[model samples]
Target: MTTSHKQAPAFRPDWAFLMRHPAHLLAFGFGSGLARKAPGTWGTLVAYPLFFLLLALGAGPLLISLLCVPLFVLGVWACQKTGDALGVHDYGGIVWDEVVAMLLVLAWAPAGWAGWLLAFALFRLFDIVKPWPIGWFDRRVHGGFGVMLDDIIAAGFALAVQALLASWLPV
Candidate 1:
C-alpha cells in the first residue's frame, strides 16, 4: 500500500466570516468557541473574558451576569461556526456554557473557593455523566441556545447537589 504524505492541518482564523456579523464580537465569553476556532485555544482564552469582564466589572457581578445573556446568544451563534469548522459537536474548549453556569452557581451558593470547587466538580460530573434531561438536551438540542441549555441544566443539578451536600456536611 502506498502512503501519501499529508500536511498538518493549519488553524485558520475566520475573521472575514465573523466580521460579517457584529453580535458575536459582543458576546466574548459565549463566543469563545468561535474565538477558539479563530485564535485556537490560547488566543480565545486570553481574549474571551478579558475585555468584557473588564468593561463589565465596573457594573458589578450582578450586572455582569445580566450582560452575559446577550453575549451568550452571540456566543451560541459563534459556537455553530466553530462546530462547523472543527467538525465536532460540543468541543470541550468551547466552554462559554461552563463559565456562565459556574458563575450562576456562585450566585446561588455564595461562598469562597470551597463552594467554587464543589461547583466545578459537580458541574463537570453532571455534565460528563449527562444524567437524565441534561443528557437528553445535550443529544437532542442543536445550535447555540441548545448548546448552552444542557450545561445550564447540568449546572442546576450541580447546584442542587452542592446545596444539599453543603447543608448536610456543613463544611
Candidate 2:
C-alpha cells in the first residue's frame, strides 16, 4: 500500500496578508513589493519619497544615514518573520532590504536629480548582479541578517562608484 501526501499552496501576499502583520507590511515595503513585476525596483523607489519626506521634516543627510542602522535592525527582524511565514528566506517580495539599502545610498547621494538617478541605477545594478563578495554573502548567509547584509553590501558598491564618479566628473 502507498500513502499520498499533499503540498502546501504557495504563499501569495495580497493586501490582506500585508496588512495582517506589521512585519509583513514593512517587509513588503508597505505594498511596493506587491507589484506584479520588478518588485525590487518598486521597493527601491519607495526610498525616494521617504528620503525627501525626512528632508522636508528637517532631517539632514547625516541623520538619515544614521537612521539606516536602526532601520536595518528592524528589517532583519521583519524579514526573518515574514520569510518564515512565506517559507522562503529571501522571498522576492520581501523588499525591506532594498528599501533600507536605497535609503542609505540616497542619504549620501550628491545633491541633484542627476546624482540621485545615477545612484539608483548603480544600486540596482549591483544588487541584481551581486558581484564577488556580494554574491558570496548572499549565498552563504541565512535568516534575517543574511537577507539584509547582501543589500547593504550592494549599497556600499553604489556609494563607492558614486564617489569615484563624483571625483572624476564635474558636477
Candidate 3:
C-alpha cells in the first residue's frame, strides 16, 4: 500500500503583495504585519511614531483622538478588501486594527515613557486575552468590522485600567 501526503497552503505575504494595493498596505500596517513573530505587537508599535509625527505636525492629544475616528473607518474598508483578497476574514497579519486601537489608547494615555509603556502593556494584554465582551465580539463577529471592533474594545479596557491606575498611582 502507498500513502500520499497533502501539503498545507502557504499564506506568506511578501512586499510585492503588500504593495499591490493601498488597502493591503494599510491593512497590513504598512508592512508591520509581515513580522515573523507577534505581528500585532509590531503593528501596535507603529502607532507610537505616528502619534509623535502627528504631534510634531501640531496635533494635540484631542486632535489625535479625533483622527482615530477616520483611521478606524479607513481600516474597516482596507481590512475588508485585504481579507477578501487573502480569503481570511481576520487573518493574524491584518494588523490595522491594532494600530488604530493603539493610537486611540495613546491619545488618552499619560505622559512620559513610563505611562506609555504601561499603556502599551495594557493594550497588548487586553487584546491578546480578549476578556468578557471583547471575547464575545471576537467570537461572534465577522468581516472587517468585526476584525476592528475587538481591538477597539481592548483599547477601551486598557484605557479604563489606565484611568484607575492613574488615580491611585503616579505614572
Give the number of the best model, judged by lDDT: 2
Q: Could you say which candidate leads in TM-score? A: 2
lDDT of 1 at 61: 48
- Which segments of model 1 are wrong by more than 4 Å? 1-65, 168-171
lDDT of 1 at 141: 81
- Write candidate 3's Cα lDDT for 4-30 as tens digits: 112211466879989999999999999
Best-first order by TM-score: 2, 3, 1
RMSD of each: 7.7, 4.8, 5.5
Q: What would the TM-scores of all predictions be?
A: 0.61, 0.92, 0.91
Which pairs of residues collide in model 1?
Answer: 30-75
Q: Least accurate stretch of 10 residues (summed lDDT) in model 2?
A: 1-10
What is candidate 2's lDDT per residue for 1-171, written digit by digit as tens? 111112221667899998889999999999999998999999999999999999889988889989999999999999888877777778888899999999999988887888889889999999999999999999888888999999999999999998888655447
Q: Tell me how candidate 3 scores on lDDT.
A: 0.87
Q: What TM-score does structure 2 among the candidates reach?
A: 0.92
Where model 3 places Cα greater than 4 Å from the true spot, the runs are: 1-10, 167-171
> Model 2 residue 147 lDDT?
91
